[model samples]
Structures are given as structure tokens and as C-alpha cells.
Target: MMNRLKAALAASAVMLAPVFAAPALAETELIFNSYLPPHDELYQIAIRDFAAAIEKESAGGIKVTIPDTSLAPSDRQYEMVRDGIADMAIVSTGGVPQLVTLNKIGDLPFNSPSARAASIALWETYNTYFLPFDEFKGVKVLSTNVLPGRQILSVGKLQAKTVADLKGAKLWSPPGALSEAVKKLGAVPVNSEFTDLQEYVTKGTVDAMVMAPNSAKGARVLEYVTGMTQIPGGLGSLSFAVFISQERWDALSPEEQQAIQRAADGLPARTGAAADEVLAKLAPEMAKVPTENLEGAQLDEFTTLLQARIDEWKERAAKKGLSDPDEVLTFYRDVLAREAKASGS
Candidate 1:
């Protein structure tokens, strides 16, 4: 009778085993390294929103943490993720040109008129053509985006009425194609990190800078600038890539991977929209600073000058072994055109 009771107790314990079983996996936490401050719209939309989406989609299986301090410099973000110093980061393609060459396609002059079109076109191009290049070998790319149209912001009495007015001006330029374009347009391009721009401007080292309106606003450029010169189709746009370390990416289960990707879907479009919002509000933000919108003959002349620079870019790209450089340019242009029309911009 005791043996019968013992057997019955063991059966009951087995029947209740499912209620106390442990989970199949532990929760995952990822570190997101960012150079931009939390208040920056791009940072909020791209990093903060992305983190929230990942957490929700993973259903508590994953959590992304963005520390209050930056883990690496803006230009070194790609290297930081590759070396495992950070799990994920947003890097400018132009910042690490040696590693991210194909992104130069978006850097071409007059590629797109607005950030919305440029961002969508850039993402589509990256997935369709640039993905196979091994440029981003150490990381898994989440999304790619472009800044709003580049404009000329001059400091303390420098005003640009035409492309010719840019000649002899000491213009601040970030590295890569934009710097080259600045030189081609006869300005003395001062290649420097964006962080040092304020100091440079305050010290009277640069007469002007080529940047997007939102970027200028974030940098508080109006404090040093007297006015802005806006160009049709913009001078050019910069490309940005969000990515995760390959090791961390590979460790994630297929379901986790899909979840993260789903959360990242349409991120480029969202970022573009955020940029448009910023652009729309710039007038009030810069109420004290004068602004000019180039038109008619001046606009046509600027377009011609940009075309020359575009030709140079194609030649340089061909030399770098990008087969059919013209084809790549044409593809990007067509994508931008389609996107702009679809968005009614």
C-alpha cells in the first residue's frame, strides 16, 4: 500500500511539471552607441524609436540600451561596432568612406530634392545593389538614410548670390565627396569633423559651411551665421547607415532577427519625414537670420556647375572599379524621381 501511494505521488508531480518549466532562453540586452544627443530628431527617431520597437517586437526577449554617454566618436562608430566596443551604431557612410564606398551614389550632386525622397531611394538602392559589395562585412545593416538638401550658410557678412560668390570663401566641409565638390566649386574646403564646426566658425576660420537645414539648427549654426543660401535640388545629401555588430547579429535566433527587421521596416521613410518636419519649422527657428531661395538664372547656373561635379564623381567611381558608373547614377536618379513623384514632393 505504501509503494502504491509513492507511485501515485510521482505521477502527480510529473503531471504538474509543465507549470514550473523554465523558459527556453534568457532575455537579450543590446547596447546602442550614439554620437548625437538625445534631443536630435534623427537620434530620437532612429535610435530611441528603434529601441522601443525592438523591445516590443521581441516581446521582452530583447532589450536595447542607449547609454547617456557616447561610446565612440561619430566617424569611428563603424569601427567601434566592428571591434565589439558597441553592439550597434549609426554611422555616416561619408565618415568612413574607405569602408562604405557604394554609399557615394547618394552623395552625387542634385540626386534628390528633399530628404524624404533621398532617404527612401537610398535604402532601396542599398538593398538592391550595394548590399553585395562586402563594404559592410563586419556588421549587419539595419537601415540607410539621407539628410535633407544641403544649403550654404555663411558667417558674419558672407552672402552668396551665385556660385561665383562661393569662390575664395573658406567653407567648412565634411570629408569625402562633398569636400571634393566644394573644392571644384572654387571654395577653399576646410575638411573637419562637424563637432569642431562651432569653434572653427567662432574663431573666424571658416566663412561658410555646406549643410542641411536641420543639421545647422542642431549645431546652433545660426548663432554664428548671418544668412543662408538655398539651392534648388540642394548642393548634395549625406548618407547614414544603422548597423549592428556581426557577432551579436549572428547570435540572435531567426525569429529574433525577423522581429528586429520588422521593427526597422520603413525607418528610412520615418527619418525622412522627421527631417521634413524640421525643415518646415526652420523659418521660425531662424527668424533672426536672413535666408535666400535661389531661382531663375542663378539656379540654372548652379545646376550646370553641379553637373560638372557629377561627371567628375562618375570618373572617380569608375577608376575605383565600380562597373558601369553611369548605370549606377542612372539607377539612383530614377529611383529618386519615382520616390519624389509618389510622395508629391
Candidate 2:
């Protein structure tokens, strides 16, 4: 009887051992600081895609949350993320040139027309010309993409046909060349974010601004902007970058890293598609905003004047010890052209 009892107890111990030895996986939660307002389609898309990818890759061991409010301006996003106020973020380097000037190539009037072309050319520029990890110290760069081509929106009916049309007009501008461009065009440049741009326009704080359709719509500037002049092929598309803290990034396992990269790998295409959707959806509403797609003689005239402004930028970059300003400009042009050809744009 004793031997039978011992045998049964031994079998029970063996059965329980496997369950006791199983390890519990560690779970991590990360956050994404968006430069977009809450629930904007692009913002939502990024959040959903990133969360899904991370969760799927981690097998419920990791999670990501994207908050809606742009708590910081576009310029401050990099610092905010690096400081670990947020684990990851999307930021505009051009908006904060003092922190990273090499990315300012996006600010030049390189005249990229389509988002697809712009995104491809931009990634190429970053890979070929820009310094990698050092360029964004303390942060792990994930992806960079371009906004759709920007258009000049004014508060009044007076079309900006020539440089002189901007005489003494007050315009809201982002930092760097875009601001300088405003000054060169004889408009006063007031630094403002999209959240405040419409208020400024409504209050007559500034007379006009240059922005993409999605931004113009997101900011509800359609209600305030008197007109939009499409400046395709005369100005470069704007760029935004996604980054994560190196500390948190390094902690992620190989599978998690690949999942994050995969999300970034498809970002340019995803963003471009989202931009197209926003443009299509916003067009009819923009019609009420009194937009004119400038082309032909008007466009030609504007292009000539804008081209002349490039010399000033070159001179400025030279003053700042940017070796080979023309070379930089040429490289951008060549890459942009190549991307256009490849994309059939």
C-alpha cells in the first residue's frame, strides 16, 4: 500500500513541474508623440499600424499608444522624444534647424511635385548625404517622409502674381528658408503653428501662409484662407521624421526591432496615400475657400522670381560654411529627377 501511494505522488509531482517551470514574458508599453491633432486620418493610421505591428510581433508582450494632442510644436518634438517625455514621435527637422540643419535640404526650393517622388528622393538624400545616428543624437531614427506639395494661401482676393504682390503683406511662416522666402517676397514673416495659423488669419494677424491641403484642412484654414496658389514644381515638399528614444529602442528584442522597421518601411507609401486621400476629400470644401491652381504664364512668372531667391539661400548657406551649396542643390535636383522618372511622375 505504501509503495502504491509513493508512486501516485511521484506522478503528480512530475505533472506539476512543467507548469511551474514555464517563464512569464516581460511586457513593455510605449507611447508615440504625434505632431498631428487627435484622430486625423494620417495620425490615426500611424497609431493603428504601429500598435498592431508591435503587438503582433511581441505576441502580447509589448504595446504602443499614440496620444492625439500635439503637445509640442513641430520643432520641439525631437527634444521631447529624446528627453523621454515620450518614447517616440514624429517631428519636422526643418522647423528646428538649429538642432539639425542637414535635414534643411527639404526646405530649399527644389521643386518636387508629387509626394511619392518627394518621399523617395528624401529617403535617398538622408541615406546618401545625411549623417545617420549623429544627426539625431540620443534618438533612434525610424523613418522620414514628405508632405504633399505646398500651396500659398492668402487672406484676401489679391493674387500673389509677382514678388511685388507681397509688398508689406504680413504672412505666417515656418522657420528657416520658408520664412526667409516670405521676407524675400516682401512679406513680413511671423512664426506660427497650424493650431494658431487660422486664428492669426481670422484676426488679420497675418495675411497669408504656405501649407499643404491636409494641414490647411486640419487647421480649418479653409474657412479663413481667401485663395490657394498651387506652387508645384517651384518649391520642395516639406518633410517629417519619426524617431524613438535610444534607451527604449535598444531594449526591444530583434523581433520587436524588425516590427518597428517594417512599420517605417511602408510609411512613405502610406503617408503619400493618406495625403492623396486628404486632398481628394478636401478639394470640394477647398472650393468654398476660393482656390486657384496657378499654371501657365502666372506660374512661369512666379517660378522665375522664386528661382532668383535660390541664390540668396546659397549665399546664406555658404556664409554658414556649408561647403558646396550648389553641389548640395544639384544633388537634390538630380535625385528628385531620378525619383520622378522612376515613379513615372
Candidate 3:
């Protein structure tokens, strides 16, 4: 009887041992910071999809979450993420030129008829030329993109049908090539960030601005801009990049890294399309905005002025060790041409 009882106890112990020894797998959490307003549905979708892909690729070993609001101001996001205040971020390269001028290839006023084409072309350029650079040493870049090529916009009706009309005009200008373009065109540029422009627009303090139409729409300031000049090759474009802290990215398992990269592959085109969709949706309304159609000599002169900016960028690129900036610029434009045709842009 005692032997039988002991045997039964031993059998129960053996049956429970496996269950007691097994442990639940821990999930690695990544926090994503969204500095821009949540108006960009496509970008938001890409981020969400990227999160899902990461989870799927890692087989649920990793999880990501985006809070309802930003973790920091738009200007400070690069620093925030670099410092590991947040694990991931998508920030405009223009805001952190000191940290990432190479990615500014997207900002070079290198215009495209389609933002999608521009974005993809720039992404490819980044991988080919800028990816190996040490500027992003503390960050792991996921993707780079250009906003919809910026068009010249003004509040109220204007006869800005010619570059001469812009002479002596005070304009809100983003820092960098756009600001330089405005200056070269004889406009007084009030250098400022996007956040500062709304206040000026609301008060009619500035005469005009060069910005992506979708950005104006996203910020709900479209109603304020009543004049426009559409440029297929924008005078300037905003560049942006998405990234994770190098420490955090390195901490991820090798499999997780591969999975995350695979997921990141979709961001550039998605962000570009989001800008286009917003612009397209507001097209009818924008059409109502009085436009200055620069023609003949005016068009040539305006383009000539913008062309100088390209030379400036090439000089800067050479300084950055591109060896031959013209070759790289040509490659970028060629890619844009091919991609534009493929996407029917």
C-alpha cells in the first residue's frame, strides 16, 4: 500500500514539473513618438502597419505603441530620440541640419511632378550615398522622405504673376534652401519654423510662403492661403527621416533587427503618398485659390533663380565627400524620372 501511494505521488510530481519550469516569454516594448499632428493618415497607417509587421516578424517578441500626443516638441524630437527619451521617432531633417545634412538630398528643391517619385528616389539616394556616413552614429535610420514639393502660397489675392511682384515682399521662409531661394528672388525672408507660421498667417503678418500644400491643409490653415503658384519642380522640399535610438536598435535581437528593417521598407513611399492624397483631396478648393501662372520669360527667369540652389547643394555635397555631386544628382533625377513614369505621376 505504501509503495503504491509513493508511486502515485511521484507520477503527479513528474506531470507538474514541466508546467512549473516553463516561463512566459517576455515582450520588448518600443515607444514611438509622433511629433507632427495626426492629420497625416497615410503616415499614421504606415507607422501602425510597421508596428504590426515588427510583431509578426518577431513572432510577438516585440511590441510597439504610439501615444495620443507627442513625446516632445517637433524641433527637439531628434535629440529626444537620440537621448533615448523615446525609442523611435520620425523627424524632419531640416530641423536637425547639424546632425543630418546628408539626408538633405530630399530637401534640395530637387523637384518631382509626384511627391511619391521624389520620396522613393531620395530614399534610394540615401542608401547609395548617405547610409554609410557617421552622422547617424547614435541613430538607426529606418527611412527618408520628401514632402510634396512645396508650392509658393500667399494669403489674399496677389498679382505675384512675376518674380518682380515678389520684390520687397516679406515672406515666411523655412530655414535652408527655401529661405535662400526667397532671398535670391528678392523677397525678405522672415526665417522661422512651421509652428511659427500659423500665427503669422492668422495675423496676415507675412506676405507669402513656400510650403507643401498638404502641410498647409494638414495644419488647417488652407483657408488662410488664397493664392498659389504650382511648380512641378518645387523651389524647395522638406526632408524627413524615421529612426530609432542606436542603443535600443542594437539591443534588439538579430532576428528582430531583420524583421524591423523589412517592416521599415514601406515608410518612404507611404509618407510621400500621404502628402499627395491630402493635396489631391483639397485640389478643388485649391483650384479656387487665385494662381500666378508664370509664363515665357518669367518662367525661365524663375527657374534660373532656382537652378542656382542646385549648384550650391552640389558644392556642399562635394564637401561631404560625394566625390562627384553632379553624378549623384543626375542619378537622383534619373531615378525620379523612372519612378514617376512607373507610378503614373
**Which has the greatest TM-score?**
3
Residue pairs with backbone atoms closer than 3 Å in model 3 (clashes) = none
RMSD of each: 4.6, 4.6, 4.0
Write model 3 residue lDDT over 1-345, tens digit each, in one string: 999999999999999999999865647899988865555664465566667777778787887878788889988888998888899888877778776766776776646556778888888988887787767768888887787777788875455677888898887778776788888788888876666778888887888778867777755677898788766667788877788999998898888899888888767888778767777888898788887666678788788877787788888777877788888888888988998778776
Best by lDDT: 1
TM-score of each: 0.86, 0.79, 0.87
- What lDDT score goes with residue 19 in model 1? 72
Residue 169, candidate 2: Cα error in Å is 1.3
What TM-score, to 2 decimals, does candidate 2 have?
Answer: 0.79
Q: Residue 48 of candidate 1: its Cα lDDT?
A: 94
Cα RMSD (Å) between model 1 and the true structure?
Answer: 4.6
- Residues 97-173 of candidate 1 have per-residue lDDT tens digits of 67766776777777757777888888887887777776888899999888887878888678888878889899887
The best-first sequence of candidates by TM-score reads 3, 1, 2
